[model samples]
Target: MRTPTRFKAGAVILSAVALTVTACGTGGGDTSGGATADAGSGTGEIKVWGHQGEEGEVAALQAAVAGFNSSQKGVKATLQLIPSADYTKTVSATSPDQLPDVLEYDGPLMASFAYDKKLAPVEGLVSAQTIGNQTDSVKTQNTYQLDKKLYGVSMYDSGLGVYGNKALLDAAGVTYPKGLGDAWTADQFQTALEKLAAKDPDQKVLDVKENYGGEWPTYGFLPIVNSAGALAIKDNKAEGNLNSAPVVKAVQQFAGWRKFVDPNSDDKAFTDGRVALSWVGHWQYNPYNKALGQKLVVLPLPDFGAGTKSGQGSWAWGIGGSSKNGKAAGLFLDYLLNDSNVTAMTTANAAPPGTKTVIATDPLYKPGGPLQLFADGLSKTCGANPPTTACVATPRPVTPAYPVFSQQFSQAFLNIYKGGDAQAELDKAAKAIDQDFTDNNNYTS
Candidate 1:
């Protein structure tokens, strides 16, 4: 079942070199492949591809295309919505000639496509001022450069934070960790967790949702590592970074959290009083608040000696180099990025809006709104803030090897959760990743 809200960004896990072949060829628009005309020749059907979601999401996309077809006379835009699970697979499986003109991709993989020359130059399609107007999250996650050209742009950003059972904190004589301003310190957070464990010996203190595999480990657990004063990945590699002293110490402490947390994978653990906090995405806002009522409060992750690291970057769109109609495809993509369209899509999914203009105007995203804390947290971690001894919004690693890296890191994290050595497992994962890098010539990044 596709969770309409699951930002299951493209699961581009295929590691074989063969995958790149399908994504690239001797093309115009930056890549070496069938030379593309200077612009959309017009009159040809412009195929747009995106992952399927809720009815409203589907409607929003269809409505965008309908508007495009109606507004233009020569180029007719058509949206082909693929199942969420098959999105990346379908893209990878398509031959160069069969690829979509415009593709909606998960924010993180933008660089991967650009690295392989699968996407076309984006700066030429849109203005620098237009790209500059995007949110920090979009700037960090969506845009990429290859050789010398900029390749992609994000349509929106998403939010991640913790849901607290306020009663659990109060009854344990602990003050709730507020939003970014009063986020708990590393030591304070652990003390609070300990207090909760002492109060209800059988209950868990934290739920980072490790059981829902795929990108959860990298997306969910990586913040703790970053918050500990080190990155989980750096410059498209993880050797020294993932196994750095700070990361190792952080993982060691997280292992201690196991004794305080219940193994249950359900979010209801908080509602049932089986847990005190659930580190989760903003999508949990309504249901979690509904369950916990006035006792619920959302908070940023504790600053683990360094700074809090909240995730940004969600889904985004870009034009493929294989498109015969780059101009028409870019038009459709830009239409989808318009304020009204962005508002509709994000509001339907209860996600944070991506652009500054949209975020400023959206009621739910305004300061003091129900999800403002989530939006604020994302700003600090992945936004324009610089990382040093303070909290910051960090972008995911830029390697084309992410799918394979995500898999190994997930296993390593699971091993640590199950009482394995953090350093050993991380090193093992890094070794495996480096080996794949050597095997594929680092995906020619």
Candidate 2:
């Protein structure tokens, strides 16, 4: 399973350091020793590596691998689990030939890997039907599809939005958005927060999971920037887009909402009724629903002038560029993505399913379901350069410099959240990102 979306406050500082160290040697666009030749022709032993997760997640993965191994005789697949934190570093340090036949990586990182030639296109290897069955959002997340060739596929994806307390909302006379089309405007959201705060013991009506940091800031708060009509990067440059007026203003506006936010140190602000609204992801659904029962309801994120944008992307699978067992690996990968296997994984992690068929049958994400808003949000993704409005989901930027790109933007946002000057922080991050891009020769190799 993925780590909790929120991290302890101090993890913010540590995340930057860990990410820097993890992505140190992963620059350039070299294809040397990469699997440029057709890989569908190879077969035999297939090695697969996945992030080590919780007991249930780990069990689900193990079961899938077992099923795949038993279903065939021409090839044998072996599974290995690595700590999520160290998975990237381990892969980066390994020679291409030493890498696993198939490896799981964070969805947004696929561009970086593909640029570095650490991944091979999964288009011809995996079954066409398996690839076609994926949701539109999943396809967008795995956008490293150079020359129209897909490089990765995921069994499940992630979602982000608001979870409201029906009683608290009604008592405050606040009307929350039911779906993407009716998301609350910035004014409406702020007013709702104020009203909800007035009825709270501590005057904190919202929980943005402040006690957490790390990727949490980027994953949870970047949408505010997007919704405010700004792209973190545009045309392979960050200077103008990321530090633009819209982005700075969005950060300032978001910072202004701190007064109504619960720190949620014990992660009980929402579950304990200390907060009327929770801005989180699908991972918290079970607990939030269990605690509030009939009072719990899922709502769309606030529309920040441009539109309501939410975050979507998660761990996905890709073939190693140097894999000799690419054909065999594809077989296991296809099996792992089958409907039953996808259901098993989604059931264990409580994430949105990657495939369209599975999503249609999911209890939480299906139409008229409690979390249907999340599914609906995914259907309206703002791709590489989406229009200012009419989009609900925004995939993280696709770039080989993303490791540095994400690190810089996330740290800048965290600084803004902690009271740093928004313009200054963003300007600094944008410059650093552009410099990295220059150092990597624009990653056009």
Off by over 4 Å in 1: 1-38, 127-129, 145-149, 381-386, 443-445
lDDT of 1 by residue, 40-155 (tens): 56466888888786677788778878877887787778788887666766765655556678887766666556555566666656556567667766676765523434456665
Among these predictions, the greatest TM-score belongs to 2
The C-alpha local distance difference test score for the whole of candidate 2 amounts to: 0.79
- Which of the numbered candidates is closest to the native, going by highest lDDT? 2
TM-score of 2: 0.94
Off by over 4 Å in 2: 1-14, 26-42, 145-148
Give the clashing residue pairs of candidate 2, or none.
7-212, 7-213
lDDT of 2 by residue, 1-445 (tens): 1134322111122255545643455544553312442465556778888987656778999999888878877778889998766666676667666778899877777777777667888877889999999888888878663444577888888889899999999998888787788889888899999888887888988999877655777778888889988888887789988898977887888888998988888889899998999998888898888899999988888887898888988888989987876777788888999999999998987888989999999998899888888888887888776537877888887776777877888889888888999999999999999998787667665
Error of 2 at 61 (Å): 0.9
- The true-versus-predicted C-alpha distance at residue 145 of model 2, in Å, is 6.5
